[model samples]
Target: MTELRDAALASKAWPFEEARRVLKRYAKAAPEKGYVLFETGYGPSGLPHIGTFGEVARTTMVRRAFELISDIPTKLICFSDDMDGLRKVPGNVPNQEQMKEDLNLPLTKVRDPFGTHDSFGAHNNARLNAFLDSYGFEYEFASATEYYKSGKFDEALLKALHEFDKIMEIMLPTLGKERQETYSPFLPVSPKTGHVLQVPTLERNLEKGTIVYEEPDGERVEVPVTGGNVKLQWKPDWGMRWAALGVDYEMFGKDLIPSAELSSKICRVLGTQPPELFNYELFLDEEGQKISKSKGNGLSMEEWLTYAAPESLSYFMYQKPKTAKRLYFDVIPKAVDEYHQQLRAYPGQDLKAQLNNPVFHIHGGDVPASDMVVPFSMLLNLASASSAEDKATMWGFIGKYAPDATPETHPGMDAAARYAVRYFNDFVKPEKVYRAPDVQELAALEDLVAALKSPEAALEQIAKKNAVMGNDEPLPEADYGDEDFLQSIVFAVGKNHGFEPLRDWFKAIYEVCLGASQGPRFGGFIALYGVDETIALIEKALAGELG
Candidate 1:
């Protein structure tokens, strides 16, 4: 494990140089065993987006990295600012028009449209929890409502007032020239009149650091800090929390630059230690547009998990922490296969060693020399053989490929293997299988099928024909270049036919080509899967009963 750590230190993946510098500075200033906290302000105004996961996932990696280096305990604090007033209605909510009147109140005061929870904030919190739980992250959620109600944040609030002048000095420069005076250092909600104290500046008592409030009659009243319950403005509040919580590190999205700037000022004012900050770029779709709930252009973690394993999803998150990158729909399957390959490569090493290896972190581990070694296509093709075959069947095939590959009866192995297979099925869509063709195309496919005797020979001929004709070449009038055409050819020749839907047939073809059903072009797939087996399987499917 120490060797692994040494390797990680030497490797580029760990970013050890930057981390060392940051850690040294942190240790010098703070010294105390502060909780390493990752803070994200959840509005509960919309469905949690991929960006939410992006923040949490990256923070988790950093926390893990810290744990790897030192014994300092870490806490990933997911803060839901449900006490925040609703600014606008979320698109998914019903009767959004009614929310306008409810805007000024806390999110906890808003009605839940789904009728499943006590309030809108509660509903959103649960949804976010379900999403996070799927990733197996160990996290502690702190609700703004709960924190305020429990008075856990009171100490920081008091510190903000004491250091108010210093905090103002840090914050005022960031605001625009026109709005600088209007921006107060705090969000003060008066308990008496429910009126917010929207003061412009520290108007009086500069020497004593006391805030002076002017009465309607023009008399100045100095408010003394009797206890640690002063409402520090947003910027000061952030800094105060850092000192109060003793957060060693936290990451935020690039979009939160404004809030981060303000928080920095507050930290200076409160004279508290500020956490190390890592800002990550947002996840974009294939088109290079940022994934946003407002735009409705991104896939949620739930949707991604439907086709990919949690580990694969985590791998995608880990690949690059701060790069502005696009996540194509196809990346998941490759990730799944790569994850399994990594697991196999580090067969006997302890878990810690496997995690710290950069090669294992990215491309994946080498296949274990003693493990069952079947081409991915074989397992996928076998899966296409029947809907019931699933991941269990795939495991059986791997075991059969290597007699030494026995069923992992242990709970851990079974769970891990199940995750790998599920990821493969959901994320990898085999492209080799075409859709059902019309009768005319089916007839042409049948004629083409007749030209082959051996599966290998037939696939070779097809490849040659494809090479000579080019991918754009027109097939006979009946050929639509879809799964039905391929199935008709398979039906014409007897092969490993399975009892499944037409969709499964296409999936089987993909399995035969790529270890997963979704991937590169079919011509390339044939090149990869080998021509002989490709044609033989087609012949087998064509000759056998539809089952």
Candidate 2:
């Protein structure tokens, strides 16, 4: 534990770095509330997306890092602003026409389109909980409607009432001239109509903790700001929530940096410091446009899971988070392979190096060993070469390469095999463009086939030369399954045929034999797929039967 603490203090991993900043906040003393609070806020206006998963996942990474460094307890809250008025119906959901009538009402008041939960907010909230729960994130769910109506936020609401002018002063300059005139921190939910009204505050009565505003019908109504009758405008509400919950750390998208800054000032006005903020760059679609829940242009969370493991998604989220990344199907295979690479490297790494390893932060220090005997790329190629329709088909080759591995013993590999088959069929198969090998490529491939066919005969000749030279090693006795020896033969065949920049040779093999332009190490593929099968595959390519 002491060694881990020492390493964590100096670890350069972003989560540990962010956690250290959080640790500084409590350098003098722990909070009076006993535990440091971490929060990730959700709008609950739409279904939870990849971005929502990212915020919580990244925050959880930091929280886990903080746990390593500090003895003080910590809590994470997944807060949902479900009390905000439903401004418009989301295009993704069903029964949009029905939801149109519920506009201007709190999301908790809008009718559920799916007819499952009590309201739209509740339905989305349930989905959010299920999403987080599936990932096994440790968090407490907080609802704005529940907090406001249950009087949990009464004190904070009253404080905002007393500090209304101060909050207004901070908010006014940021708005346009027209909006500034009518802007008030409090949005009162009409008692008669259930609409959250955004109107100018005609009067403030701090003694009674009430605000007076004129409704659209020209009737003036005074309502207590403490109850569910009113909710603060988003910016002020953000600050008030931070103050009310005593959040120690919260991270938002880089797009919200200005809102974060404004909310910080408002938090100070409410007599509490804002949580430590980390602004991450937003994800972009394949076309480089910023991804949005409404636009629906990027990869969905379910889509990612369909073609890869959840950990791969986490791995994607964990990498260089401050830099904007393209979230698309093309990125999935690379993420999956690299995540396993990190896992494979973790056990061999030292304590400090392990601390910096992604799997360390990803699994909260209990990193698992990668059971992937076959790289995901290899599996994908195997799927393509074998025309695999299911995981069981890929496993036929996988079983030969790794005899002991099974669905029960190596679940990660089993899952990867399944993902590989799905990914290959969906993405790889459609785009494959096999071409006939040019003259030099054809000669090199023919040489490879000859070598594969008579490897034992060539080994006998090598053995004779070793005996003639009185060499003790006896040429190290390799069989058809030896990837390095087979790889050397391929390399020699290419070089013998005068192929320059040798990648062209590999590319020729992939394009001619595999119907792809790139692939796993040929040697490794042969070792897994078998030498006889590879020779047969090469013969097919030579005879123009592959494409």
Candidate 3:
């Protein structure tokens, strides 16, 4: 327990006291094992929003923290409520007309126009799985359709129904409804009909321990439940699930605070332990509106991977308080840059201290010292200047110098690069190597190049030039040129300004080339490819020849 407290305190990103309290409760209530952790979200009714990842990413941190403190083997379950009915069409999803027709049914019942899967639910599930997998999350995905079909949730459902009145009583105030008569507490999706099940009159029969429902035609029926229709309504579902799963901790958005409050009441009624609750702020788009699939304003996890590294994305999710404030995509690059700087600052310190910092909010308020390290992109650019086929060679360099760099550090990098290479053939552009440079950047870059007499001198000149430019301006872009010319510029820059110990130099190059201030390493990138080819690739970029 003491060690656990120390770990929690050490991780500044975490709400140490809150986490500690939850762990203490788990220890008291069930000393045999810690609680199960469930992270749930709706499927990609459209593109999966960044907020969805926020929930899961934060949960991963809490789970990791628990694992650090105790011997509890935490299970992080990412349950997709794909069986839920679609209330509206999202911007990213196609075939709007067809979706509208199936919106009333469970997601699994909706036909998939893309044909990648059997249903819309399956398609979205696949996408979500791909996104989570890219993040290196070890999550057990439980689809609502599968859970219902497999009967894994049957017991919990029955229990909720048995406590119907209590559940309704707990939920009404939260919903600000006079009574729970308008709609049934259950979602009421008919598994047989593949449509919504509408019961006009739903009443709890406490004595009979059943839920009595009346059809439109005036036919009445009673569905028997175990424990007197003790099922929980939506508001109390959180507590019910926590008890059933023995969850130690869970996080929700502020929008769900009312539900969480009601859930606490249910926990008391059920006489079962409830998981600790951590509420976080929602993610907003540039518009300041909540980033939601319904609004079609959110950034998808896939889109993020297309441009940024996985560690950057993870770091974005890692640094904030779950309950603090809204997040934006525009802030991500800075977070990534800071993560690199932090790693470099205390490189020789205790691995834990080096890895742990609350600044890059992964969990609520704690960031553990990460054992994983990867070459920054700037460093990679420096290396690419030396090696043309830089991918493999860069990886080898990483294996030697940064062995701790895991797949999570650079998610989808290989696959994306492979895709780009396959698409463009042997003519992949330099912008692909780094991000496209803007107009002002081109002038600045030309000036820096003119100042250099050799490759090493170019590096020093570039660094000095950048220092003069300050942080307010964008980075300079490379001018259009021949392969040999591009090679000379890259070589000159690498000689002086390049990061040191090779890895650092590579990181520095990525920073300079992309104008990102920090990115993947250069040495490994050059080792992955030959120097001449890489130079040619940069020339192609300057000329705007490759896509």
Candidate 4:
């Protein structure tokens, strides 16, 4: 009993709080099955984008959090909305001309221009599954095409058919005039062409569960609600899907608020309550423009995994999920560093604080006994400066700092090294920024070089100059790995040399070393990049060689 209470207390973090609320509300009115559920959606209109990864990753984090707080056995569903008609050819996908010919057909009925799967929907579905499985996601995949065709939705289809008029009343107000004129809760998939038609429904036979529609070819035909002959229009389909699956909870982007609200009303009319919902704000580009699958304005999942770790991406999803996040490539470095901080700081934190730490959830509560890897941002900086295409680049410097590390034992180091190299090439190479240092900055750079070259004598000189600062923790013996080491050095340099605030000195340090005015913590960077190499950067600045 006490364990349960403590677990619930530890779940005070925002994601866990949301998880606890969602699970408890569902438990009050439990589904027929004893287990609870969480769901995320995917649209297979094109290749899987970063937004798709974010949806599933964020949902998985919540699932991990919910598991900590309660014993509710939860299931996460990755449902693909594949029954939707192909509206247009995506520019990025192959065989645009072929896909254009298949537009207006159900995605499941359209040609797989890539020739990888049976249909366009199946091709993208396979792509989605590839990354999700590679990332080790725990999910049950469901396809709308299979569900409808296999009669899995037949009973719900019947219920919706019976309540058609009510569903129409709920949907009509949300449509524009032209769409309103032709809108019906049911979209009949034409037998001749296998395309979901948008034309006005000619007749509805409630007793026979059939709808008649005039085909574009000028022949009128009736199709049964079962056997995949008819598919619910998107709004009604949302409600029907929830009722059919007994979904307990789901998350979507906030742009679908109106659609979700309409679906909730339709669900009520179908005699079941809507699932609990979380609407995350849209992902934006660096310019703050919204990312759309159609617009192709966001990064792809394959591109992110090419340069970074899944854990870093997962940590990004862990924070401020409800708030809008800028998800361009630049944001990846901070997330990588923050994940490192969480893992490093985790060992000393109390149980409750550890529960709240993202690394705990990122590992799904059974955190490894040790996670002693280099900070990702530091590695990115190190990798950016070095031309090494592999871990050998980082290993040369890493051996100088920590003689204990080798490929035989520290697998984490190897993985981080590779990611850092990829990150530098993909993101830092083209946009590398540099600034020249002025006179005071030059002297500061020279002092930094001097201290790094002669560590013991440098601290002796520092203590003699600033006695009050070095008594408790002497500079030479300090752990270079700690962020405090760099901060203290910057603080000491600023106080002794009359550079009022330390950020100026740190800024100068970055300008000289990294060719940027901002970077990872300097002490940490030196530890990862090597003392001699860092000192060379200061020497270069002193000689005006960088300019």
Candidate 5:
């Protein structure tokens, strides 16, 4: 347990903690392979999506953790089920009519609907590769269509052929009567028309390694199970891939629990235990509806990167992978801000706390060591309040806050300012609802602002100070006012005024001063933006000029 407890402190992550538990079980069960294997599946029925990004990103983090814990090597096999038959024409593609015409054809056999590659599968695979490569993901992508055609899956295909009856018994009872009557463990692609046929198997010969099925036109076809002639049904295919690749871990969506159950059973029946499974909850939209490519509901890759860094998106997925969370654009700022906060504070925390932090893992255990003078959210608030339409206009606020600031000197601020400009224009401008502080709130805020005006507050302390604090303690002798000092001051001031919820104090401060209900942490903002400017901003709001 010491190793396990301290493992979390050694710059490793939870999923790595997860991987370690699974690997211990795997090592006891089977030690044929020295290195652990992690597998993630990509279905190319549509373009690469945020969900796809999440799967790969999460898997990679686990893989990274594995590398840290063990001297043994590891690999992430990104398997693409490109051989699956096209059921319907996807609407996002340009050549929908052509796709409809080629329904039921294997994805790799159908011509590229978007005219980008040799086949639709290849096109989608290329897109997936391009997207993954943009993130510098370390992976080896496996194509089912090519693997089947090249006979790489032939051994597993043969095993399924031999266990055809058993596989059917495991699968058929779970399906509807109609499907049960027609279902087979194998779906053979016609060697002639190249359509993946779903007809019932008329006869199977293990010795000959072939199954006979009749085409819709009443043509009887006998094809060998090996060499791209057949494909195991989805459930059995998943099981076979696990056994065949020696996959020790597989992470999947929560919706596939039933399928995962069946697949694990199939794996057991095939004489191998199921791979270690990690089923993550589905990502939902702002309305809590499931994000689906077919339904077109959720943030897109382009939209996320448009207003936030890729690190922010990575950090979003790193938090509670098993718990359900919204992936809408509105969640973007907080994710970005959180990522920045964790990175900034990583140096201050112990290795244990650092390892537990999301940004610690999102950054591959290497956090950027500098804190931004102003958080991205503060910059957004500042930009929106100033009605600044661009990054250049937002620079003065950041400069005033951090005297030595410039695009080059404070790259984080520069990038954030630029993002704040666009994000303000898109989401913040029309949503502004400033409310004046009431008399009670006003009096407390005035005292706080005056304290901020003293040049001995959160931002100043954050910039140069450090000391442990308790209730109503004098300001830390250090120059910068870190989170502790900020928290202490806010708590003391709010307590003095008998402010219930305490949040209302910050809310009033934010609404009156920043013209938004939420902004950056009040303490950090005050320090970074400096007392005089904050005093002026709050005084103007009190003057009703801001409202």
Candidate 6:
């Protein structure tokens, strides 16, 4: 463990790098809160999205990395700002007519359109927890509604009231003149209407710990800032949360960098250093537009899970966090394949390399052995070829390729097979555009078909031809079961028939036989789907039956 800690200390993986930053916060002394606090905040204004999951997943990775290098206990808080008023109804949810009436009310007081929980905020919070729990993240859920009403934030609220002018000095310059005139850090909840009123404060009394604001109807009302009567504006609230909870670390999207910086300054005015911050680049949709929660433009957490394992999403979150990635259904298969690829590489890696490996942080150093004998991309190809509707059909091909594996022993492979079929039916089937191979591609396909028909004799002749050309590396053993030998045969066919950039050969095969422009390695597909089956598939393409 000490050796692993040494490796972790020097490891350059982003999680370790971020964890090291958190560790430095206590270089002089441990936090007075007893344990280092890591927090991920949720607005709960809309349903929990994939980006929401990414925040917690990435923070957990840093927490896991911290655990490896230090003995200080750590606690992760999944904080929800549910007390904020709902400015508008989310178009995605049901009962829209009912929600329009609840605008400007605290989310906890708004009706749950789903009708499953006490309020919309509670419903969204449940969804967020379900999403986090589905991935087995260890976190304590903190609701703004509960915190404020329970007096948990009372001390912070009083402190903000005492430092009100300082916070206003920090925030006022950033807002336009009109907004600056009316903006108050405190948004008081109107006693009569039960709405969170953002009206201008008429009076400030620090001695009473209350503020006076006039209602729209011209009624003057005085309310204590503490005990859920008032909530701070977003920037001040962010800093207040960090100070109140003694958070050691938190991360947000790059879009929030200015807000985070402003809040960090506010935190200092509140008499606490800001948490260590990691501002990751925001996700983009397929069209390169920034993903918007209200616009519903990108993949959702449930949508990603519908087609791939949670860990694949985590794997996607783990890689190049500072770089913006397109989060869409099209990226799922690649993420799944690459995640398993990393998993397959883990057991052979040394401790230093393991510390840097994504799966180590992803699974919190308890990485599982990958049971995926068949790659996800290949399973999708098989799904396309066989029109597979279930894992059972894919399992037939899986059983033939690796006779020892089964659903009972290789559950992850079983899940991938299921996901592949669903993914193909949903995304691949609709986009398939089969085209007849062009002249060069046709000739290459014919050569490939001929070589596959008599693989053994063709490989032997190709070996002699290579030998005569002074390239005397022996051909891979020409066993029908040998995928590499089959690949070599396909490569020779493509090269001999002069398919420039040889990928054209594979592309031709996919377009003509599989109705897609690119696919898994043809040889591996053939080995798994059967050479005889591939021969018939090509014959159909040639006969115009496939197109």
What ranking emerges by TM-score with the best candidate at the front?
6, 2, 4, 5, 1, 3
**Regions of model 1 farther than 4 Å from truth:** 1-11, 15-22, 26-30, 33-41, 116-118, 190-235, 348-533, 536-547
**C-alpha displacement of 458 in model 3, angstroms?**
15
Candidate order by decreasing lDDT: 2, 6, 5, 4, 1, 3
lDDT of 5 by residue, 21-81 (tens): 6657655444577677888899888888888888999988888776666656788888999
Q: Determine which window of 10 residues in candidate 5 has minimal summed lDDT.
A: 462-471
lDDT, model 2, position 459: 60
What tens digits encode model 6's per-residue C-alpha lDDT throughout 1-547? 8888999999999999999999999899887778999999998988777888899999999998998889999999999999999998888889999999999999999999999999999999999998788779999999999999999999999999999899999999999999999999999999999898888878989999999999989999999999999999999999999999999999999989999999999999999999999999989999999998778888888899999999999999999999999988999999999999999899999988888889998999999999999999899889988889898999999999999999999999999999999999999988888898888888878777787788565685577557645887766666768887778787777777666788988888888999998898877888999988888989888889865
| Residue 10 C-alpha lDDT in model 2 | 97
Best by TM-score: 6
TM-score of 5: 0.86
Q: Candidate 5: deviation at residue 2, Å?
A: 13
User: How well is each residue in 417-503 modelled by candidate 3, as lDDT tens digits?
Assistant: 322222222222333444444554444344334433245444445455456446334434432222343443444344444324444
Cα lDDT for residue 440, candidate 3: 40
Model 4 spans with C-alpha error above 4 angstroms:
1-6, 26-30, 68-72, 384-389, 433-436, 451-460, 467-491, 527-531
Model 5: runs farther than 4 Å from truth? 1-13, 25-34, 435-505, 521-547
True-vs-predicted CA distance for residue 7, candidate 3, Å: 4.8
TM for every model, in the order presented, reads 0.66, 0.96, 0.63, 0.91, 0.86, 0.97
Estimate the overall C-alpha local distance difference test score of candidate 2: 0.90
Candidate 4 lDDT over 1-110, as tens digits, reads 47745765556776687787776675556656767778888888877777788888888877877776677688999999999999888887788888888998999889
